[model samples]
Target chain A: MIERTATIASTVGLHARPASIFAEAAGAIDAEVTIARAGDPVDEAVDADSMLALMSLGVEHGEVVVLRTGDDTAGEALDALVTILETNHDA
Target chain B: MHSFVGVGVFRGRVIGPVRHMPPALAEPPVGERLEGSTAPETAAAALKSAGATVKELLQERASRAEGAGKEVLEATALMATDPMLIKAAIKLVNTGTSAERAIWEAGEAVADTLKGLGGYMAERSHDVLDVRSRIVAVLRGVPAPEIPDFAEPFILVAEDLAPADTATLDPSKVIALVTAGGGPQSHTAIIARNLGLPAVVAAAGVTGIADGTQVFVDGATGVVSTDPGAAEHAAVAEWQEKASLLSVFDGSGRLADGTLIPLLANVGGAKDAQEAAAANAQGVGLLRTEFCFLGNSTEPGHADQVAAYKGVFDAFPGKKVVVRTLDAGADKPLPFLTDATEPNPALGVRGYRTDLTTPGVLARQLAAIADAAASSSAEVWVMAPMVSTAAEAADFAALCTAAGLRVPGVMVEVPSAALTARHILDHVEFASLGTNDLTQYAMAADRQLGPLAALNDPWQPAVLALVQATVEGAVSQVKHSASLETTSPKPVGVCGEAAADPALAVVLAGLGVSTLSMTQRALPAVAAVLRTVTLPQARALADRAVAAASAAEARELVRAGLPALAELGL
Candidate 1:
């Protein structure tokens, strides 16, 4: 498992458009991905490709969410996802 | 030939075969009766079928129902399965009647019983009408009996039409409409005039003519004839051609006598602003800001508010956009507004009154409008809704001004505001009358309820009395402030349904209203109406309107009063 911490950078946080975008990107990769807010017990786990699951988490801008991925290409997926979140997907 | 006349809601002269709507689609047949005496089993199946039909109908109309309509539908669905209707159906089945016949008889009996119970049944009937119409339309395989198509521009005739049914018209193609079963203030009539289609509602015997019969209809005269003589047809055609030519706007909102009346557009959102700009409207007269709060549980934050405001402001760069601050309350409830509960919400804390209870919400909204104005070149003017007294107007003005926003106006939607307009103008830059609400309040009529609909007359002397009071207050304010040159004259504007109405527009302009703001779709027709009369002529029309007995009479009087201008335009 590869784990990393990323800060939300989308202007609208994780509510509408940004949440959908992040979920789409996560789901494209073949890995089991889980996200949790820092120090929060509740974690959202999915196949890394479901937009609905990501939106249901209600992640917002400036919040630090921890991500964990487990798969053959877990390292590459983790690095790419962290970079996207950090840049807010250039939104 | 049997002819039924209703109101023509949309413009279009169509000639099509009469297609009655179908009954509701039945669900898969419940198992057949096992024997000759299976009353209970048959009753159960019929009840199940009715339940399924009601559920499907409710789901179909869920998105289309407005706030009150939604609640009414849910209540109606519950009533559909009420014990009374079921019991009646069972009794009929036990007597050896067929399932469909039993259900129909039970429905009629229940309808009659509930009619005596009053409002609930009336509302349920409306739902039933809606459901029945849909089922009928489905059965007939017609596109909901929309405006028909004729080779030549002609008159459309119908028995009755839903607002949704009326909305499906191509205004450019339709000339006029005559209906058999709608009152003057019916949604069909309102929508007809809004679309610039001359329509006569409640015209009895409109549908008596056979299909494909040539008909001559004078929408202005409420006259219709089947297979009119050649001369009559020629005259009608000539009049329509002349009217079409005269409805053109010359970019400058001026009459032949050169009286400049700024024609503005009433917009609901950013898209409407763009449409207004495209249509060459002078500017926005009323930019309703309530859409931002729709479908939400909490008041929009400052940023969200700013973004929405900015969208409108940006759409009309360098043009005036008057933003009415969140004019929400009982009539338009927001899920986030918890304290808005009231039996008579229309008369309750709404518009500016609701703001007083939640000052923070108002402040945030005002601040966002200010911030949006600062960011865009669009000139933004802020207004408040439902200011009944001068003090409320003054306080609202102070808040907007303090926030660096140009507080151009307050809407006089209440009769009290019209009565106290002079005092209210003391605090604000200008005022606009929301005639729809003012007329409702002045006549003590619930505008939403259909039976009290007669009292919703815009031309009732009582309503004109309020308008007269508002105009008098405005004139007095202008005169008193004339000496102070720094203080610009408080120009009152009419920014309501009344303003969009071409006939009413003349009356309003004559009543000392400097600007008329109406729906963007109405700007052209209103502009056409403005070009037909001078300020003096408009005033004369207003006088006639004030003296008229009914709205129809008032409309006729205004049209008659503007004969010369009307001749020039039409």
Candidate 2:
């Protein structure tokens, strides 16, 4: 599995607009992807493509969150999603 | 006709059949097992099918949605297609639970988890409930909970409405709104005014009125009548026709004697500015500056504040725009700005007083307004709220001058400021009376207290006396002072609910208020009434109103003088 950890950088965190954008990006990829707070258990991680679950995580700015993908070549997808998480959408 | 009373949200009259929103759906039975051995497998398939139906519906809605609605609907659609939610429901079904019960249980679990996270996530908890209801409705073979389709415009009757319900409502389809419970500042009233729909809120027993029963709703006087007679119906039709004609009058607000009153609108932010301008408001009378700071954890940056101020200023090119500085406190407490847990927040440090202690907060705002004004053709005038003393007024005017603001004014909301307005106006260029607060202070009533609402009448003799004192003070200043502008008596405008009342508006104008600013929906009625009365007749109405012993008496006295208000059923 390909996995990465990134701190949320958006002023409003991954909520409303940012969550939708992240979920839409994850949905476009051809691999299973999940996200959760860094220390959460594997089962607690939610489908990254589900905007509702991503928003329900309540990942605030400066909090470390993790993303995982089943495909080995999904490194590019993970990087793109991480960039969005680390950008301040409010600005 | 049997009648009930509420607080009128906006001035207009309409006759339509009552339409009650359907009550909330009953809870689906929990933990019920299916009939046979194939029940578990059958339940899982049904659950999947129901979820898909919900998914398809939400996806369709999302496709047509725009802005925030689009984001919310798309997120909801995602929820319907969520594999984890489906799996959870299936697990429940594996234990012989019914499909509807399993889906309900699964939806609640996720909703509770999100709510447990608190803050913004907790807000989305309601969205989970919305999704659950849609899926359950599909499983139960019933129509999803939504506004019923109707061929004709109808008066909407409801206990209360969620923000989403209001977002989906077509204003044209809603002839008027009547709610059993809500206040002037409630979402229903605010939305009704924003959409230019007449509304009456807090009407007791309004929910008891049967759907499809013909009724007359007078949003001006807050009267809801059932089985209106022919004459009452004709009166409503006449009022509606006159209102339409009044709305089309593009000419500026003036008295019968050709004395210009300059009707303006009280706007919260730029979003409302365009609406006010379209309503034919001469300019913005009160541009509240709190919108820029409300949601921010910290102070908004200079550029952000500048952009917000510029949006409003640009909307009123070549017109007088009076902007009030950040006036948050009490009912609108800001954590970054003040303590949210004050005992008596109304009397606590607020408005310009908070700006004094915070120092740079007001300075940054003034700088932003100055920056916005530099590029706009609008005649921008800046004002401070809740200023009680002359020294504070002088300090604020000095700050405005430092920031390059041409016009500096103070809101005479406090009685002390109104009584000592001559001294306050000596330093400030103008004074605008926020009659809501002034009435509250003058009558010793809390503005937000429902029971004390009666005491917070602007027509109260004491309140009018205070307004009279302020106007007379400003007149005295303009007449005596050599440094001040002598063209007009340092323009004093009424920018509050009082200005919305046609009779009280005339009294305010008669009391020497040079301008009247109110919610845009109320401008036409006030303007229409103003066109019927000469300046002298207005002054006489003011005199009769002020000479009365009580608010009710004062209102009656003034109402007697303005026979034109009878046509509008004021």
Give the number of the best model, judged by TM-score. 2
Model 2's A-chain: what TM-score? 0.95
Interface RMSD of 1: 18.9
Give the per-residue lDDT of model 2 (tens digit) for B232-253. 7887888867777667536489
Superposed by TM-score, candidate 1 places the C-alpha of residue B27 at a distance from the truth, in angstroms, of: 18
State residue B352's C-alpha deviation in candidate 1, in Å.
2.4
Tell me the spans in candidate 1 whose CA falls farther than 4 Å from its real position: A1-91, B1-182, B194-198, B205-218, B224-240, B243-247, B297-304, B329-331, B338-341, B356-359, B448-455, B478-483, B547-557, B564-570
- Candidate 2 clashing pairs, residues 3+ apart or interchain: none
The lDDT of model 1 is: 0.66
Residue B126 displacement (Å), model 2? 5.8
Model 1 lDDT per residue over B1-570, tens place? 223344333332323233222222343233323246655565557555654566465655555677744644554444444444555666766666655455555555545543433322222344443433333343234443345655555555576556645644666655566666656566657667666676766766556655556666555445556656666656666765765665455446665588887888888788878877777788888888988885444567888888888988887788778889887765566634524336677878788887766668888888889999999998888889888888888889888988898765798889889998878887888888888888878888765544555677676767877888888997778677646664445778888777766777788878778888877766766677677788888888888888888866886777776664345433
DockQ of each: 0.02, 0.44
lDDT of 1 by residue, A1-91 (tens): 6778889897546533455456556757777687777777644443334333344355667998888876646888888888777776424
